[model samples]
Target: MKKTDIILLTGLIGSIIFSNFAGFEKKLDKIEHEVLRMHILANSDTEYDQNLKLKVRDKLLENSDEIFGGCENLEEMKIRANEKLDEINDIVLDVIHANGYNYTAQTQLVNMEFDAREYGDITMPAGKYDALRVTIGEAEGHNWWCVMYPPLCIPAAEKVESDEQAAEDYFEAEELDIMKNPDKYEVRFKCVELFRGLKEKLSK
Candidate 1:
């Protein structure tokens, strides 16, 4: 994702954190444990490598129907994804070689922190999330990430409904209301936005 897009998405996240402070910790606990993410890094920042990264992403998504389809919970998802690491690598290899490139791909399952991530109407809180990281060669390029288990971006990429119920899956009813209806809490949203903006500027 581009820098501008990140700021926009995280801004909405800041709004959530600001408005939902009372129950934020409880909400975060649920998110930290439930959300599963995927990140794909390119070989380099060059256009060719970046495009190759996306090609690999598409191939993985195309082949992921079964792996993600069978899993119901995070643990099951982790196990299923780990089992397919080799198969995922092979798919990436095929894409690279077919394109006359010589880069290699590696896949691993890990627990890591993720910034607030948005997919359409849903925004995940900034916290630790389980992930499948795919690095291509040097892996220094801008990355592409998505919610893997709930299949948020997958359906969007495939022109489907795109996991409209993702927030419900990860949040309690009260928190889901806060996420879906932020306008009802505008005061908190603005305060959070200002504080976050100031923090970013101070850090820079």
Candidate 2:
């Protein structure tokens, strides 16, 4: 190809790439804003601690209705969750004590960054999300996380057949398509994550 033709072709390709990334980023931003995440960190990686983590998760899930009941949207859920922070802490403490562990648990609301994560059939893209975070003891171990507002982790709590069904009620068709088909957007997701990482580093 001629020099002019080559330059034009390269510019065209760059524009196409930028356009696709912008579209993906916009959808991701919507998803991030509309969703609430639940993050629970274990006290340690010891087998006992890990088991305790699961127990804690179960207790929370069992009380999911109380924690999230009567919430219409993300903001309502956030307010209800905040109001119930004390109750949430008590629930965690009850689980820890019953499990014969004295680890202190702290629950709070925060905006936190998360990596791309898959739960059941849904794949959440990496981004910053508003989260209800629970830290146990030193909180140095692996963590468990899930979509809290949509009640994906606790289908029974929401009377849904599955997490995907619960998700469908909240996510738009295109957003659902993006999540249910992660392989289609793997490259775009990675690009966005890398861009965000670099941006965060630069900001710091």
Best candidate according to TM-score: 2
User: Which regions of candidate 1 fall more than 4 Å away from where they truly are?
Assistant: 1-22, 163-171, 178-204
Model 1 gets an lDDT of 0.76
- 128-197, model 1: which lDDT tens digit per residue? 7888999999998999998876667677688666456655565577666655665665565455456556
lDDT of 2 by residue, 34-114 (tens): 989989999999999988988888889988887788787889999999899999999999999998888899999999988
Locate the minimum summed-lDDT window of 10 residues in model 1: 21-30
| C-alpha TM-score for every candidate | 0.73, 0.88
Give each model's whole-structure lDDT: 0.76, 0.88
Model 1 clashes, total count: 0
Query: Residue pairs in steric clash, candidate 2?
Result: none
